[model samples]
Target: MASVKVMRMKLGSEGLDVSAQGLGCMSLTPYYDQPKPEPDRIALIHVAADLGVTYLDTSDIYDNHTNEMLIGKALKGGVRQKVEVATKFGVSFENGREVQGDPAYVRAACEASLKRLDIDCIDLYYQHRIDPRVPIEVTMGELKKLIEEGKIKYIGLCEASASTIRKAHAVHPITAVQLEWSLWARDGEAEIIPTCRELGIGIVAYSPLGRGFLSAGSKFSENPYEDYSVLSLPRFQPENSPDLVTAFKRVSRITQAKGCTPLQLALAWVHHQGNDVCLIPGTTQIENLIENIGALSVKLTPEEMVKLESIASADNVKCSRYISSRATGESSCTPPPSSWKAALKRIFFYG
Candidate 1:
C-alpha cells in the first residue's frame, strides 16, 4: 500500500526477478536476542510484503531452524510466490554455539531445511559459513547435486573470502554471496567486492545501516534493540568511538544537505552502489521497516559519495565485525592468527 521505489534484479542468470530491497528475516524471529511470538513474527513479514519488499533473507541456524518455519508459516497460501525466499545452511548447533562446516552435515541440513520450509525448491540456498575441513569444492559439489535434483534454484555463500568465492563459483555458479557490508563495517571492499564483480555474483549487503548506528535514534548509550546492538559487540566499543561514528557523521552531513534522514541516506548509498548490490536491513518494528523501505527513494550523487568515502577513510575505524576468533567457520579458513593480535588491540570495544 505504501509507495516506494522498487528495483528488480535477476538471481545470477537464473531468470528470476526479485525486489532490489530484500527483508532480513532473522531479526523478526531471533538470533539478535529474545524471540518474538511466532504469530506476531509472521504477521510482521506479511506487513513487509504489503510494503513492497519482495526479497527475504533467512537462515537455518537462526533459532535452530525456527526462522525458516516462521517464514513458511507466514507465507501460507499464495503469499509464498509474492517474494523471493533466500535461506542459508551449514552452521551446526550442538552445544549452543556454531560448529565448523562439514559437507555431509550440509547435505542433511539442506534436506531438513527443505522439509521445514515446506517448499520443494528453495529460491536461493547458501552455505551459511564455509567449512575448513571440507574444501569449497566438496561443499559446492554437494550444492551442485541439490541443484541437479531441483532442490534449490540458486546457490549462495555467506561471509566467504574472494578466493573461496571464486573456487565455489568455478564448481557451480554462485548466484549470490551474503556478507555484512555497511558504512561502519566494510571488510568486504578489500577483496570480496572485486571478486564478486568479476565473477558476476550478486552481493547481498546485510546490515547496510551499520546495524542501526546510522539511524537518528542510535547513540552510544542506546541499544538498537532491547537485547541486540551491533555496537554492543567488542568492535563498536567506545574505545574506537572516533571511527565508529565517523562514517555515520559524514553520512549525516550529506543527508542533512539532501533533506533526508541519515538512515535513508545509508540505505540509498547501498542502493546506488550498482545493480549487482542489494541491501537487507531487518527490524521487527513496523515503523522501522517503513523507514527502511523509504531508503529506496533516497538517491545519492557522485559528489556526496566522494565526501562520504573521504570522511570514512579519515577515521580508519578498526574493529572486527564479529567477536575475536568467532567468525572462524564461514569467512576464513582458520582462526585469527597471532599476527592479528596487534589489530585486535585497535578494535572498538562493545558489549
Candidate 2:
C-alpha cells in the first residue's frame, strides 16, 4: 500500500494537534454490520497509523466496551505513543440505558475508560451524551478534575447544544465539540458551529458520510427494513429513503464529474467546512479506510461546494437525524445548577 500522510490541525486553542481526518472506531464492532475478524480490524488500524492517520475515536458504549478493548490491543507495542486516543463516556448502561454526567459517574467513567484503553492519560475525553438531570457545570467540573489529575488531556462533548457547550466551556475550556455534521446533517451549522468558533472550540464531525447513505445512495442497505440499525434511523425508512436516494444520486453525478467517489465528495464537503472542523468517518474494511483517506486530496472550490450543497441541502434531505428520544444536537442542553454549594462539594470530594 502506498503511504499517505494526512494533514494535521489543532483541535482547539488548548494546544492539542491531530490529523485533519480521524478514524471513528464505532463500526469496528457489530453496531452497523457484522463484525470482521479481530485481526483484520487490527490490521486496518495499523494501516491507518502507518499512513499517518493517528487520531482514533471510540466510545465506551460501543458494544459494551469491546471496541475500546480492541483499540487497546491494537495500540500495543508502541503504537499507542504515535496516536491520539479519544474515547467517550457519560452514556451509562447500568440499570438500563441512561446518560450519566454527575461528578461520581463522570469520574468512574473516566477511570474505566483509562483502564480499558490501557493508557496512563487519554489524549482527548468526551462526554458521549448530555444528561439533562445534571447541570453542565457538574459534568464539566468532574472532567476538569480529571484534567488536573493527569487522567485526561483535553475535554470534548458530543451532541451538545450551544448553551450547554458554552456553559461547559465556562466551567472548563472545551477542546472540541463532536456532532453529526455532513451534507445531509446541517442542523449544527445554524448555531453549534458558530458557537464553537466563537468560543475557540474545535469541531469534530461524526457521520460525515450520512451514515453511509451518501456513499451507497439507494443501496445503502440491501435489506434496509431488515437491518435493525438502519431501521432505527428515520431517514432510512422506505418513505424517506427514496427522496434521500434521489438527492444522493444528484450528488453522485457531481462526484463523477469531479473525478471522485460520493464518499469522498461527502467527506471533502465536511473538510471544506473549515480547518477547525475535523471529521471521523468510520469504516470496517481496509479498502474503505484507504478510500476515506483519499478524501483529503479531493479539494473543492467555492463553486463546487455551493453546487454540492444545493443538491443535498438540509431542506432536500428527509427525516430527522435520529429516531431515538435521546438528547441530540440543539436539544442537548441541561438544567441549571440547583445549588452551587452542593455542586462544588461533589466536585471537591469527587476530585
Candidate 3:
C-alpha cells in the first residue's frame, strides 16, 4: 500500500489549520448500529492517525458521550499532541430529547465535554444545533467566553441559516460551518455555502457520502444503515433509492473510467469545491477508512467537474432532510428554480 500523507487546510481566516479531511467518529458507538469493542475502536483511531488522518470529529450526544471518550482514549500515551480533535457541546438530553445552544447550557455542556474527552482544551468546538429559542449572538457570545477562557481554540456551527450565520459571526469569528453536504444534498449550496464563502468560514462537509447511500449504491443487499434504522428515513427508502442511483449514473461513468469507487468520486468533488471546504467521512471498518482516504488521489479535470455539477444540480438530488419515513409525505429536496425561491430553510437536525 502506498503511504498516505493528508495535507492541511486553514479554517477561514481565524488562523486555524487542520487535516485536509477529517475522521468522523460518530459511528464508533452504538448510535450508528452495534458499537465496536473499546479496543477495536481505539486501534482504528490509531490506524487512522498512521494514515495521516489527524482531524477527528465527535459529539457529546454520540452514544451519550462515549464517542468523545473513545477518541480521548485513542489519543492517550502522548498521542493527543499528534492530532487535532474537534468536538461539539450544544446538544444535551432534555425532556427525552435534545435542547441546544442556550448560554447557560453552553457553559455547562463545554465543561462536561472537557471532562469526558480528558483534554485541557478542544481544538475546534461547534454548536451542534442552533437553539431557535436563543438569538444567534447570545449563543456566539457564550462561545466567545469559552474561547477567552482557552477552553476551545476555535468556534464552529452546524446546520445554521445564512441570516443566523451573519449574526453569529458579528459576535465572533466563526472558524467553520458544518452541514450535511454531499452530491445528494445540495440545498446548502443555495445560501449557507455562499454566505460562508463571503464570511471566510470554512465548510465542514459532514455526511459527504450521503449517510453511506451515495457510497454504497445498490451493490450491497445488506442495508448499511440497518443498525441505525436509517432505512426508515425517507431519502433512504426503496422508492427514493432508485432516483439516487439514476442521478449518480453520470458520475458512476467517470468513477468506472478512473477505477475508483463512488465514495472516492464524491469525496474528490467535495475537496475540489474550494479551499474553504473540508470533509469528515465516517466508517466503522478499517478497510472503509483507507478506501475513503483514497479520494485524495482522484482528481477531476475541469470538464469532469462540470459534469459533476450538472449531476449534483438541485433537480438531480431527489430527497429532503427529514421527509416523513412514511409514503404519504412529499420530498422537499427537489431542485428549485434557477433562483433560490425554495421555502426558508430552518435547521432540522436530530442529535
Candidate with more favorable, higher TM-score: 2 or 3: 2
Residue-level error in angstroms, candidate 2, position 164: 0.6
lDDT of 1 by residue, 96-128 (tens): 545445667767888888888888889899887
Error of 1 at 76 (Å): 0.4
Error of 3 at 240 (Å): 2.7
> Could you tell me how far off, in angstroms, the CA of residue 304 lies in candidate 2 after the best superposition?
1.2
Off by over 4 Å in 1: 33-36, 95-97, 221-228, 242-247, 314-316, 325-351
Q: For candidate 3, write residues 195-278 as lDDT tens digits.
A: 999999999999888767667665533443344234544465555555556776777788999899888999988888887788
Task: Name the Cα RMSD for model 2.
Answer: 7.6
Score candidate 2 by TM-score against the native: 0.89
Off by over 4 Å in 2: 2-4, 218-229, 324-351
User: What are the per-residue Cα lDDT tens digits for candidate 2 across 1-351?
Assistant: 534569999999999999999999988987656889999999999988888788999988887889999999999988998899999988775887567889988898888888898889999999888898999998898899999999999999988889999999999999999998888888889899999999999999988987677776646534445433334455555666556667877887888888989999999999999999999988888888888998888989999999988987655676566543234432121212343334322221111
Clashing residue pairs in candidate 1 (N, C-alpha, C atoms within 3 angstroms): 130-330, 232-351, 237-349
The local distance difference test score of each candidate is: 0.73, 0.82, 0.79
TM-score of candidate 1 versus the correct structure, residues matched by position: 0.86
Clash pairs, candidate 2, are none
